[model samples]
Each structure stands twice: as structure tokens, then as C-alpha cells.
Target: MIIAIDGPSGAGKSTISKMLADSLSMHCLDTGAMYRAVAYLRLHGDIPEHDEKSLVQLVRKTELNFHHTTSGTQIFWDGIDVTVELRAPIISQEASRISAWSAIRKVLVELQRKICGSGDFVVEGRDIGSVVFPHTAYKFYLDANVQIRASRRQQQLKEQGIIKDVKTIVAEIKKRDFHDSTRKDSPLTKAAGAILIDSTSLTKAEVVQKMIIEIEKIKEKLGKKGKTN
Candidate 1:
């Protein structure tokens, strides 16, 4: 079974998804990291911002991999570990832009499908529940208020020693949110039948536990139907 968790930035999707995957003993696929990796590579290369054709070509030639370890999820691009490099703010901003391209999304969607085909995975991304895995066994959409989201992001940046004013971070987040929601290809929206969870005041453990309850309900329903048949 596959669990799809979709949400915007700083909504606690990553932490929740990782915990949920570990509890279930399943693989966790961080789709956002894949886009970030691409963005990181593009920033270091000759790829232009508006060159969709070149971007598509670059994606095809690149090999992206995700590995789950005792430490955490590690991302690789063409066999090079980029776990730390992809976390830069520059790459984060560029990732939000690159992911809006339809051609790039198509390639990544295919890659995502192939990865989840053979194993149980907790996959999280903007479109994971809505587009990438519409038929997934469990789908969740996590969200929080814009201000709260911005605060969380600000705290994260501060911890990384990339200090910035709250106003600036909030502005940047709002800009990215607008682009993500209004993008033509695979705009971020909750999938039909997805359970919505607002993390405005919820702790990380609380969110994970709530999702676990939902997953249990799904398992019960499936099991009952199977026994009836």
C-alpha cells in the first residue's frame, strides 16, 4: 500500500511522512527533494530559467535516487550525494519554480510511479495525492495558516544559521504559495477523498498520530471487505 501526503511548504508534511513511514516499516519518498536536486543542479549549470526543452533534456539524462538510512533520507543526483547542498535557500526557491514546468513534472511523475510500484512508500509532495498517486490507499492534505507556516520556515532557517527577517521569509513564502497554487500544470490542490489536517496548532507527534489513526481505519475497511469477499 502507498500513503500519499501532499502539502505546501512548512506544513509539517516532511516530518510526519518520515515518522509514518518508519512506523509502518515502509520506504519514504521525498518528491520535493527531487525537484530541489534538479534546481540545485540547474543553478550550477548553464541551464536557463525559461528553457523548458533543455530542462526536460537535463532531467532525462540525470539519475535521481533516494535512500533511507538510520540518519535520515539522503538524496543522490547521478550517484552524487547532495543531501546538504539541496537544502540551500537558493535551491529551494529555484525548485518551486522548476516544478511548475509541465514537461519536468511529467518526467518526475513517471519516475515516482516506477519507484512506488514495487514497495510500500509514504510519498509526500505538492501533487502526490492529487496527481501522482490518485489511487493511493491513503491520501492526506496537510496545511496551516500562512503566518504560522512562515514562522515555522523562519525557525528552520535560523537553525541552519541562514538568518533572515521574518517579514522577508513570509513574503517569499507567500510569493511561492501564489505561484504554486496558480501554476497551470498540476497546481497544488487537495485530491478528492483526501483527509485534510490543519497543523496550525498541532505538534508533529499529534499530526503523525492523527494520520496513523486514519491509516488504521483504512486498513480495517480493506480487511473487512476482503473477508466479506
Candidate 2:
């Protein structure tokens, strides 16, 4: 079973998806971190962003792996654990920018599909529902107001010991939303049949519980059809 959760930044897709996966005993993959790892590689390796050929080659040659532990998911880039570094604010912007390139998305999208294909996964990202798992039975698009999203992002960064002005975060999210939605290769969008979840005023637990209920309903309907057949 594959559950795709698509959303803009700070909508709590990562946290909610993790909880949902735990509730169902399925693995959860964060596709954004994959791209962020790419950005991390380029930045650390001194590869130019506009150098598309180099970027694609870098991604193809480097090995990206995800290890989900009791605490959280650990991302390994080329056998080195770079999970903590990938969350830096600068990498987020770079990941967003590089993600616009068609070649880059093709490589990472293929990788994402291959990873999720291996197990029952709750996949979360900008395009998981719209592009990565378009045919999945369960899909959800999580969204919240920009201000609320910014506030949430601020709190998250604070937890990471990275402080930024709320207004700055708000502007960054707006810019990110535009980039993600307007990207050419696989723009961020709600997939057909995906349930729309507005989490502006909702807590993370509330969102995950609502999603679990919907998933169970879908599972029950599928079971009935299978038995009938």
C-alpha cells in the first residue's frame, strides 16, 4: 500500500505523514529531503547550480539512502550521514531552485518511485500525489494559510536552533510556493481523488487521525471489492 501526501512547506506534511505511517506500520519517505541532499552535495562539492550536466551527473553517481530509526529518518548521501545538514535554510532554497530543472527531477523522481516501490510507504513531498504515485488509491493534499504555515515553519526552525524573523519566513514560503507550483517538470498540485486537508487551525495529531480514518475507509472498501471479485 502506498499513501501519497502532497503539500506546500510548513503545512505539517512531514510530521503528519510520519505519524500516519507509524499508525499503519508502514515506512515513510520524505522526497523533499532527497532533493535537499542533492542540493547539499552540490553546495559542499562546489558544483555550480547552473551547471546542469554536472548536477545530473553528480546525482546519478552519488548514492542516496534513507534509514528510518526509532527517533527519525536518517539520510545518507554517498554513504555519509548528512541528515542534519540537509535541513539548513540555504539548502532549502537551493533545493527548490534546482528542483525546477527537468533532468534533476527525472533522476530524483525515479529514485523516489524505486524506494517506495520496495515497501508500504507513506510518501510526502511536493509532487508525490500528483506525479510520484498518481495511481495510488490513497492520496491527500495538505495545506494551510500562508501566515499559519510561516508560523509553523518558524517554530520548527526554532527547535533546530535556527532563528529567523516571522516576516522573513512568510516571504520565503510565498516564494517557495510560487516556485513549487510553477515548476515545469512536475509542478506541485493536488492529485485527482486526493482528499483536501486544511490544517490551518488543526493540530498534527488531529490531521493524522483524520487521515487514518480515511485510509481505513478506503482499505475496507478495497477489501470488500476484492472479496466480491
Candidate 3:
């Protein structure tokens, strides 16, 4: 099965998706990282901002790979391990902007589909449920209040020894939410039939358990239907 977890930034989609993938014995595909990687390249490389053709050409020439180890998954861009650099706040903002480009979205969406096409993967990103895997049986839209979301992001940055006030983080997140939701290509949205889980007051474990219960219920229903057939 291809399970899609879609949500805005800092809503715990990454952590929860990893936990859910582990619990379900499925590989976790971090689609957001892919966009961030593109953003990283755009910043460090010579790709022109206004040139769509340059972006598409750069992406096509790039060899993006994910290496899974006991420590965690590491993303390599063109054989260079840029896992840490991709998480920078600047990259996040750029990812939000460049991801709106139709050409960029088309390339990355194709790569995402190919990676998860065989199934048994838990994918997380802004548009996974709505655009990448719309036909998947298991889909979730994880969200939280803007304040709670910003606080989570603040904590994450603090872990990296980069301190930022919650207010600044909140402003950045709100801007990202606007860019992501209002983008012309593959805007963030709740796909039809997706279960919305608000993480405003819930722990990560609680959210995972709730999703597990829902998945089990769906599987049981499908099993019984098979028996009847």
C-alpha cells in the first residue's frame, strides 16, 4: 500500500510519518526533502531563478538518491550528501517558492510516483495525497494550529543550535502556508476522503496510534469484502 501523509510545514508530518512507517514495516519516503534538495541546488548552484528551463534541466541532470541506514535516511544530491544542508531555513523558504513552478513540480512528482509505485511506502509532503498519490487508499492530512506549528519549528531549529524567536518562526510558517496553498501547481490541499488529524493538542504517539487504528479498520473492511467475494 502507498500511504500518503500530507500537511503544511512543522505539523509533525515528518516525525509521524517515520513512526507510522516503522510501525507498519514500510519504507518512509520524504518527498519534502526532494523539494528541499532542489532548493539547495538552486541556491548553491548557478541555476537562474526566473528561468524555468534551467531549473528543469538542472533537475533532470541531477542524480538524487536516498540511503537508508540504522541512523536514519540520508539524501544525496548528485552523489554529495547534503542531508543536513537541505534542512536550513533558507532552503525551506526557497523550496516553498520553487515548488510552485509547474515544470519543477512535474519532474519531482514523476520521480515521487516512480519511487513509491511498487507500494509499501509511507510518503509525506504538501501534495502527496492531493496530487502525487490521489488514488491511494490510505491518505491523511495532518495539521495543527499555527502557533503550535510554529513552536514545533522553533524547537527543531533550536536542536540545530540555531535560535529563532517563535514570532519570527510563526511569520515564516504563515508565509509558507500561503505560498503552498495558493500556488498554481499542486497547491497543498486535503484530498477527497482524506482523514484530517489535527495535531494541535495531541502527542506524536497519539497521532500515530489514531492513524494505525484507522488503517486497521480499513484493512479489516477490505478483508471481509474479499471473503464475501
- Model 3 stretches astray by more than 4 angstroms: 68-72, 224-229
Candidate 2 has its poorest 10 consecutive residues by lDDT at 220-229
> Each candidate's TM vs. the true structure?
0.93, 0.94, 0.94
lDDT of the candidates, in the order given: 0.85, 0.86, 0.86
Local accuracy of candidate 1 as per-residue lDDT tens digits, 67-87: 875335798888989988888
Worst 10 residues of 1 by lDDT: 220-229
What TM-score would you give candidate 1 relative to the actual structure? 0.93
Task: Estimate, for each residue in 85-195, the C-alpha lDDT of model 3 and write its tens digit.
Answer: 988888988888888899989998988888776557889998888888887778899999999999999999999999999999999889889988998888899998799
lDDT of 1: 0.85
Q: List the residue pairs that clash in candidate 1.
A: none
Error of 3 at 141 (Å): 0.6
In model 1, which runs have C-alpha deviations exceeding 4 angstroms?
A: 224-229
Tell me the spans in candidate 2 whose CA falls farther than 4 Å from its real position. 224-229
Candidate 2: residue 78 Cα off by (Å)? 2.7
